[model samples]
Target chain A: MSVTAIRETGHLPDLSRVPLVDEVGVEERSARFQTRSIKKESKVEALRMVLSMIDLTTLEGQDTPGKVQQLCQKAIHLHDAMPGLPHVAAVCVYPTMVGVAKKALGKNNIKVASVATAFPSGMAPRQIKLEETRIAVDEGADEIDMVISRGAFLQGDYGFVFDEIAAIREACGDAHLKVILETGELGTLDRVRRASVLAMHAGADFIKTSTGKIQPAATLPVTLVMLQAIRDYFYETGRMVGMKPAGGISSAKLAIHYLVMLRETLGAAWMTPAWYRFGASSLANDVLMQLRKQATGIYQSADYFSKD
Target chain B: MAGSTSRVPVEKTYKIYIDGKFPRTESGRFFPLEDSDGEVIANICRGSRKDFRNSVVAARKAFPGWSSASAYLRGQIIYRIAEMLEGRREQFIAELHLQGLSKRRAKKEVDATIDRLIYYAGWSDKYQQVFSAVNPVSSSHFNFSVMEATGVVSVLAPNESSLLGLVSNIVPAIVGGNTCVVLASEEMPLCAVSFAEVLHAADVPGGVVNILTGYREELTGQFASHMDVNAIIYCDSDTDVAKEIEISAADNIKRVVNRTNTDWAQEKSQNPYLIKETQETKTTWHPIGS
Candidate 1:
């Protein structure tokens, strides 16, 4: 577990050098992003972009193969009645259901993302976590969303958390790796920023906000801090990273606000699904409902939409 | 300070009520409700189609819990609303008078409104038993039918008898466990917003009864067309507007209840059948011994 073998150059940035988050500034800036009015055609475009950037996810203990298959179907055909709608970026599930999701999503160009590393709570042994990542990647997961060891991270064992993320990233092989900070457990915006930098340096292709298993899973201020970290990381290393804010964002209006924040913080270069994603279970239908309202000039009903 | 010069009277802008909160209309438009002498009494929210859409969303969100609430609890809450209205009796009479009703007629309408609420409150838990039936079927099954709330309802409160009419339309729907989004009389919307405060104070849950004041010409189509609203009850005698509502309601096959030309002040207006209007008959067939 030598620290020098983690990257190609074997060089990790100074952990203490990560900038401290200005709580007041971040809150004001994030709140300001919501005030920009996107109307008509621009709104419709933003809605479609939000749809394309979604990682249609179902990560419940009661998740069956049938449920996984149904979620994949939803990813493929999001409101078939509305023509010209974009399909989602991916379908996220547990490691055990990755194979089921992969088979169902066949050739639809929608990726199958699986959570590994003892998801939600990363309290397991490092070796077993690596094994889980390998298993999901072997089962045809296009992307791996692994949780960080919050227990160790909270205990000031930055090296241990960094090593675990680097090991998991290696086990993912060609599949992209998304590091989950589960910011709700991190407790502070400063810690969230520090963890974002550590994950990006440790070889995470993406830094996600939460595992969606905690209260206050995702919020504007936390997301703003992570986006700033990514921007700074890109400026220093000349390498781009992705972002995924999962859970608690269920409205079309709120999702549009996230888009506004992304555009303002990261600029147009990071607007596509490859650079950003939303890990949500109930967000797809809401976006569809809004689109239907836009099309017919009448508000929609959940009764008409298929329940996932 | 006690002997300070005379001050200007404070005027109020009556906003719409949605989900137990009073918010100005999203459209930011207002209409002046003038007295008989053509002097402006107050500015009322000119609620738009967007407001109706938002209220429908609130009503639909409230439907599941309200529809499943105990019938006894619903009855008690309706009774509580009557009590709150009685406490505010003078304020409502003054509002009715300000809207151009004669002083005596205003007092009468306010009292009748209170009694009407009590009448509906008494019928709340009993209507299901009165409306349900145990049918004798040809098969060996115990066939029984019961009344169930018809999800979200959209109401166009009568233009005339503003206070009494608004309460009459709202009470029956909610008594049956249905949530409603109601549009108050455009010409006389003062008491409707005031009555919303009574509902708010009485512990009628947010979204159970949302009150909006606006022009019917602009909002009737939206109220009827919303797919989330299960029924639409229009109280005006405008056949053209009613026909328009009926046509828009056909999109979702929504239940349309036409109470056109009904006088709310009469005793005939208070009946158990009004509660049945926004209710659905759900018949259950249980297997029994042959």
Candidate 2:
């Protein structure tokens, strides 16, 4: 067997016991999801669902308080002309801007999610990483999106990676911890599955695909592998872990494909924002544009939509 | 006949050009072109409104870069298209002949089309000079109005002359730095697709000119009513359809240019005024030194 079952330590499952991802099968299955014909009333409903599932995010070096506030406003009122639209699931930002986002999003019920733990790299020390996670949680972030140490995981240091995630989960206190695997850097589907299993065992409320910084962030095949891991974890532990495919999901059509994949893989129970989230900012406007097209029976332009 | 070797001919699958690529209509539908005898000559893509919608999106995406491009570069690119067309003159002549034109007429049309492109290429950089104005202002300020390309124009090529009419409508709009989505002649769409090939080989950017082949009745409404389209040029003389287009264009107050009943073959049809049709005049008021 190519995959040998690694020995289990404490509560962590044997790494090898996690099934090896059949790259071909996973890719073919993911491609099938894109072929589903979602049209008319159903398409409108799916667009609404995609809009509701987005974690309107802006994690940039040039990010300012003003930008974060504008994103929050966009999240709160996603197209005022289209009444009865659901607000986004959350507004994701850096740790420092979490407070600003939270204040701007106040009482609107939109969650504030912050990326912590030396995000995009996870290159910081364990103590500082946990401190950053704690500060974001203290700043009233409802969710803490932390990147797993890809370098450590790549070097076969599964124990260190697992422990670090466990510590951050502890530091998160009442907030949800979404573990970003940064699958682009993980290299292979096998490692992505393993990392997903590890994150789940280490207490991740959600397993996100990318940090929106990598070149091939949040692709369908990688996302399919992660969602399958979530499924297997659910069957084994009777716990539901959410899935988020961030980065590069800028079009509403692609977002609908993700929803189809989620429904078929995890059944209808995992169809809401509580179980599925799209960590995309540009995707909101696209969904709005599609909705307007559906309503007006004419093609839409981006000029009318608000900037993220 | 018995000694001659048999060779199979490869027929080209005619497809619509959108965003610089030859793609079958998203609707996956096609209409067969027939000769005067009613025999199937070839199959052309029966473009849908969705295809027009997609082309509008492409034209809108290409608008910013094409609109901001320098006039000199636009002129050079338009000239390059003419050069390419001249190089492929035999192919266009053959296509027009296959589409039921006399060989003599096809040659004449192709030659005239090449000349028309060169004419527009020269005007690309000179039209602003001819149309711009230096107005006398009451205040101590310099006021000058210059021509600016409208964002995206939707054109319905004349059914009478496929190649020449399509080129006449598209070159003027794009030469002035505007991108366009044009529906080719339903009866004679062969040259239009070949012309798209010429554009691809030329330095013209993707989405600068998208060519679709379909019935005008189905697409004319979409072409006129699309909010993203800045102006629409209808060349057919269907008064009722033109009325419908004019009424629908009011939704967005789109500039509708009626070129119906105009002979595209005439020398008087080609001019810089056609370029001005798709351009907006912007006046700048500069403050004088104190």
How many residue pairs clash per model?
A: 0, 0
Estimate, for each residue in B1-290, the C-alpha lDDT of model 1 and write its tens digit.
24577677677768999988999999999988899999989999999988888888888888888989998999899999999999999999999888888899999998999999899989977998899999999999999999999999999999987999989999999999999999999889999999989999999889999999999898888999999999999987878987899999999999999998898889999999999999999999999998
Error of 1 at B260 (Å): 0.7
The worst-scoring run of ten residues by lDDT in candidate 1 chain B lies at B1-10
A1-308: candidate 1 lDDT, tens digit per residue: 23224342224567788889899999999989888878899998999999999999999999999999998888888988988899999999999999999999999999999999998898889889999998999999999999999888888889888878877877888888899999999999999999999999998889999999999998999999999999998898888889999989998899999999999899999999999999898999999998998899888899899877
Quantify all predictions' global Cα lDDT against the true fold: 0.91, 0.91
CAPRI quality level assigned to candidate 1 from its DockQ score: high
- Clashing residue pairs in candidate 2, if any? none
Model 2 C-alpha lDDT per residue in residues B1-290, reported as the tens digit of each score: 23467566688988999999999999999999998899888899999999998899899999999999999999999899999999999999998988889999999999999999899989877999999999998998999999988889999999989999999999999998899999999999998998999999996899999999998889988998888899999887888999999988888788999998888889999998999999999999999965
> What TM-score does candidate 2 reach?
0.96
Give residue B240's error in model 1 in angstroms. 2.0
Give the top-scoring candidate (DockQ).
1
| Clashing residue pairs in candidate 1 (N, C-alpha, C atoms within 3 angstroms) | none
| lDDT per residue as tens, model 2, A35-135 | 99997999999999998999999999999999999999999989999999999999999999999999999899999999999988989899999999989
